[model samples]
Target: MVGDYQTLKNIIEQSLLTALFQPIYDTEQAQLYGYEALIRGPSNSPLHSPIALFDSAVEHGLLSELELICRQVSIETFAKLGLQGKLFLNVSPMVFLQDDHPKGATLSFLEQYGVAPEKVVIELSERYVVNDPELLAQALLYYRELGFKVAIDDLGSGYAGLKLWSEILPDFVKVDRHFISNIDKDSVKREFVKSILALGANINSKVILEGIETEQEFYQLQELGASLGQGYLLGRPELLPVKILPSVLTTHQRKVKYGNYLDKLASSVFQHAVSFDSQTKTGAIVDYFTQHKHLHSLPIVRDQIPVGMALREEVLELFASPYGRALHEKKPIIDMLSSQPVVVEADTKLDEVAKLVTSVHDEQLLWHFIITEQGRYIGIGSVRDLLKQLTEQQLQQASYANPLTQLPGNVPIYQKIDDLLTKQQAFHFAYFDLNNFKPFNDVYGYAKGDSVIRVLADILQSYCTAEDFIGHIGGDDFIAIFVSDNWQQKADSICQHFDQAIRSYYTQEDLNQGGIVSPSRSGELQKYPILSVAVAVVEPDVERCRSHHDIAELASSAKKEAKKRCKELGKSAVYLCQRRGPDGL
Candidate 1:
């Protein structure tokens, strides 16, 4: 497209290019996550499009020179804009192997622009597949050592595929948009997306769904559990500074929601358990315990397997007796081990272990529980520590409970989400809110509004099991975290029950009229529909959600859709953000 090599070289030398930025949004937080820097050639020239410009550079043997100039321009322009988030700069793998590749140039530009290394994510597109994996690996390692994050762009469509993903575990992966377009109607595409999500989860990589152009596609991806997304629908690339859209603002605000309670294990809570071989002398064991007063019990192990436990009180009591030290000081520690020591697997739930300690009828034998991994001695868990952990957890739960409804509040809900994310568990986050609730409150007063809220809370609790988490997000908003497979049925039942029960709150005349006559905000009289429940369900991709914030954002978006549906239909609505699986079929 360009005149010749000299012209291409002149373009690079004179920096005849500029950077345009597209924002990447966090589906959970509904905030601007970062901006991706895209390079453009002169607007009046044939090289205006990046594709044509790059092609021209490749033909002229000036690809590396052009790429370096683009990188430099992007860095300078991004800094001038004073962007608040990370800057994603696209780089080709081939440039890394170039002899004249500006090594440390990026770091210098960052310093010149006052940008932090952590705020930059080096995006490697699959277009320039690395012919030498080892060289690319070395280059990536070098960049990582300099504190820059790495991302793989156009992941599924690229030649790199799974092999490159495995060889160099990137911090993020951008899924090609072909899998996202019309995903709501394509079953096979949905399955493929699901598998990619699973693979991302397996590798702990954040997957960003790109090229979304429609509302259905965006919401469907959000429903499928994608936390990071970039598309024309979310935002379009522009030269201006980042400004969040009104739709994004209304959709992203997080409300408290329910999540599964994390059941911590004894092994996870206690880390300072001391153990000794059975042959160790009683005198030495006593000395060790005396030096470590924090230890309440000691485990006697044989071939890494815990055989018995020595209760501190019993050992101290034995030594306290008259001439007790003289009689038993030199004997093997195994001689003093309790005959019926309590043993528990490392994976045993903390609650179960607590029961074991409390069930001991003999107070003298109530001591530490020996923790084992695969039937081998790992450590000892003190009764005191177990009780302490339980008390702390109870206090935390109480603090996070909504006083009016006695449901879990925001903190617990967030903790539950975090726990699920850490364990890579798949679950649904449902946000339920009362439509036209404010109008009802204004007309009927606070007491009736409170009664309505309580009724809704009761219905949610009635349908949910002990395994599910129910939370009150204050006022008429509620949340339910469903871990079971029958969540759809539960959601349906909740909506139906609320729809039928809400009619009782209104008088016969109001019911017949279908709504109530209320004063509009501008003092004009208007008809407001009766209160109805709307449930928005978001099934987050485990791999994409980094924190509870991500899940909360997606749930908020779903809730908005549900509320919209209720406004149009004048009835309770249940909307699920659609998710796709790995198998396209």
Candidate 2:
């Protein structure tokens, strides 16, 4: 026990708890909105892991001391690094209720360091429990009164997480890593995550999905409305002297090595196959494929089994063949098609599809291939039809996606805005622009600017909704149109999510530079104002005094007001601008 004391003391005094800042990105803006403060122990030490350090501290009856030290270190480190976003620090429930609680002292210490409770999010790790609901609620209320935000950590990691959420009513929920790690591969996980997101929505609690280490998981979570993400994929946990990731051949190479893929076939394809008796007419087969653009051919079956595929080309040939009359007459399509047809199961490897395509190219005639499940016809996939459909789909996607942000572009953006506008609903439009973005791009190479753009896109996509149209209007500009009867409230909610995501995505160096970097424009060090957003509210226009364009113009002007404040003050603050629609009599 004596030895343990000396070791623990040494560990705490030496600041053994090093921090790794995993980027929390906003899906809509694709920006670093905030960070989770992960405590890493000393290298080669028994307390090298955060779990180990905290557990040992708790066991040694030093949970409060350890947590307080972690909080101080995280704040000091963050201040020194010049980070502008929120800091998420883990706190055990036991530590929150320590008998000799130093909550007042802790709050004062943070204020001295210029860290406000509002910027310091206390992640409520369920490592310990509060048996009394009233006690827990009181503790949370105390924190809330101090402007401190509380989060329920490892949500969905244990039994009865939903119960915990209901009881705690936390300001945020950090989803367990298990659900995020393999989200792309498991439908159940995706559905489960979606449900959790929906729940968070109902409570107006922010959902910070943890442990996303792959692009597949990132995309999946973004689509499912995960507001913030933290994991190795966005940025790994590391000590200070945080470096903004560079754009280089090596960076590209690394992503290639660790890249994640969805499915081989695009998820949007629509196709279905049907089977018929061998005695079925050729005309019947033709009608089937003609009706479904995705279905390229029909299978000729015998005894509820696939005998062979009646290639579309075979039917076409019969129309031109000497037996053309038989095509429309009493002749069976099976008699004309090859009795022995190539068959592929639904789970067949992508390589197998390539091989089949190659083998068919050698044949005199070309046609659609049959897809089966356990030797039974399930669908038909034609190389030609696939090429055509995929091409059109890709084109459509390109148009919808913002060229700069790579988010769904202006088309969907306008569509969503129109829906709310037509309903005569009040909504908020948060317009964002990068101050000195062109100069930064001029210095850092267009590639770096592209990275920044992607970051912004990701932030907006993750935080907003299908109903909330997020649009990128080129060059450091983005617009989020959120429909809500209470526009100001919704704007506030979005702003919180946006701010957190931006702070999490960037490294200390990125933040310290004021988003400028060593790279220079015109050989001068590049500098930029603090990255921020401006919001404007456009209420329903019952008097019909303005057009959509006019309302949009008014919102744009309001955004300029926000930008002007950021330029003059150099501080983060929400500036709300409202235009009295025709409704103001």
Candidate 3:
């Protein structure tokens, strides 16, 4: 074979290797999550494929060298591309433990490229069994200490198996592609993936399905609630960073729409119940329940911590018998209390709470759940109230979500902004819209036009922090509230990614032409360029923009300026409104 030891050595010395990037998508967020850097030998060479290239290196005793080169080149190329999101770089366990391996070189390259360690996931293939598990574990700990995330690759098909998974407890586990192929029709594969997902959830690890090549596989994975995915169907390895496709975006939006209808529980729905000290006599509770007939349940607390609950029916039943009141009235209320009620944290989901309540076969279902903050009783939630709130939320989500993207509509957006303002919190409100979107709609028809909107929505949702809020203001208009200080960076990233992704929507001829011919309002033909996003950022002064209307007005002004700037510069742009001083606007 031409790819022998000598040829491999020559290739490494000449630096004939290059890197290709394939994107990984977060199905839940429907955004471009990150790219995995794949190494390749020179084109038209016998070592073009990675298998041949790496096998040769292993035979030549230069595997460590080749891996180092791959990493360095991958980092350099990724940085040069100015790609957003994480970079998944593969590392062989054997190569990783070599004495001559470049341990510090990775961190050095990242520093040189200004790439954060947090943005790189060190992917270790489970196929290579580690000779020194302790050393590898130490090395992995070092990587984690430096803020690098670790992922186990080819999990099910490898020798490492559960032993390695248990020992490492990696941040991510990549399911082997064999299970992902034709997964929609393979019940065995689907169940395996589901089990993996459950295991991942239990360990707080993210499961990334690899080598996805079909729409059915992707949809099935999504249906199984797999979050991270990478495969040819999502994107093929390319010299440059890959953008998420419109179809993926649309699928994500559909999933989100369905998820919105799922029941959600909010602690606010629980009513504030009167609580009595555990030391109080039964007579006091009897008198309170007698006086307040509307109270159904009462929390019995000790040092502000709920010890148990007293249901109205149980307490009233005791007083019904002539001798029962005299027999137990002098006893402490704690003695008469029912078995400790179900205690749920303020943020527990209703479905989970329902499960907990129903787990007991007895009459506990009728008991009110004690809601607590930091283990201290705050309120009580009845089954009726929980059911009602869940139904209301479902109805509200159905009505309040945008039909196209299924994002929260304008009403919720306004309410969120108003809530932040009421709390006197600082937030950056951004308005996003597509440049030359109408012409795109006219040329591409409604289906394709909706795809563009969904992409934008996905981008916003993906880039935003959990604390941030995203809402569709209808059609091409959208709003995002950024509570993080890095709002400008996020806005710029959204614009940049949108610009890169929008090109895929157009034909090669149209892209080469830089614009398309479409009819104007007067029935005359005009050239309209491909779609670009314009973002308007406004960091409202708390005192000045006291209402959602005030913030919207300022954002609208900034949006106009941003659109104007885009037109002038002939590209996407983000314009921030000048901030007001602390004194006043």
- Candidate 3 residue-wise lDDT, 201-290, digit = tens: 999988999999988888899889888898987888999654544466544654564454444664856787778999999988989989
Model 3 / residue 179 / CA error / Å: 3.7
Q: Least accurate stretch of 10 residues (summed lDDT) in model 2?
A: 254-263
Worst 10 residues of 1 by lDDT: 250-259
lDDT of 1 by residue, 171-191 (tens): 888989888889989989888
Residues 281-364, candidate 2: write the lDDT tens digits.
777776665676554456678875677776666566666767675646467766877646556676654445646666764253
Model 2 misses residue 43 by how many Å?
5.5
lDDT to native, each model = 0.80, 0.65, 0.82
Q: What TM-score would each prediction reach against the true structure?
A: 0.46, 0.51, 0.62
Q: Evaluated with TM-score, which candidate comes out highest?
A: 3
Off by over 4 Å in 1: 1-3, 245-249, 252-585
The list of candidate 2 runs beyond 4 A from truth reads 1-3, 10-17, 40-48, 129-134, 223-225, 241-585
C-alpha lDDT of residue 3 in model 3? 79
Candidate 2 root-mean-square deviation in Å:
11.0
TM-score of 2: 0.51
Candidate 3 pairs with clashing backbones: none
Candidate number that wins on TM-score, 1 or 3: 3
lDDT for 441 (candidate 1): 85
Q: Total clashes, candidate 1?
A: 16
